[model samples]
Target: MSAERQLTVLSREWCHLCHDLIEALKPLQAEFGFGLQVVDVDADEALEARWNELVPVLLEGEVEICHHFLDEGAVRAHFQRIG
Candidate 1:
């Protein structure tokens, strides 16, 4: 198997949905073995502008896997495809 990759979550501290998504992804991380990174959109001007309304965006590289919520099926499929 290839080494695990990093998954990015575009988020802000105040977003409960964002936090929920992160919590949901934890089990997926354990199963698929990928690193999770949570980025605060408010910390960067462009990221804030681009993703302000789209908090809880999940990405593998530049490809957005899910947004607003954690799609467990899609996440499994993505890892399966990449695996």
Candidate 2:
């Protein structure tokens, strides 16, 4: 993976789904060697307002890869595309 490629998880500390998604990404992150960042939407009022309903959103830069769950296929495809 290129150092420039990163995946961001918009998460909430209290959300089980958010935790699940982050855990799910760990193996993929190790395999793909992409940077992972987890952000709490609740930390920012604007972020919370915009993504209140989508706590476990996955993003590559500003582009959303998936929401509410981890899509491993989409993530793999993204890596392939970038390569």
Question: Which ranges of candidate 1 are over 4 A from the true structure?
Answer: 1-3
Residue pairs whose backbone atoms clash in candidate 2 = none
The per-residue C-alpha lDDT of model 1 at residue 29 equals 86
lDDT of 2 by residue, 1-83 (tens): 76567889999989999999999999998898889899999899998998899779998878888889999999888888878
Error of 2 at 68 (Å): 0.9
lDDT per model vs. reference: 0.88, 0.89
lDDT of 1 at 6: 93
Tens digits of per-residue lDDT, candidate 1, 6-53, equal 999999888999999999998888877889889999899999888778
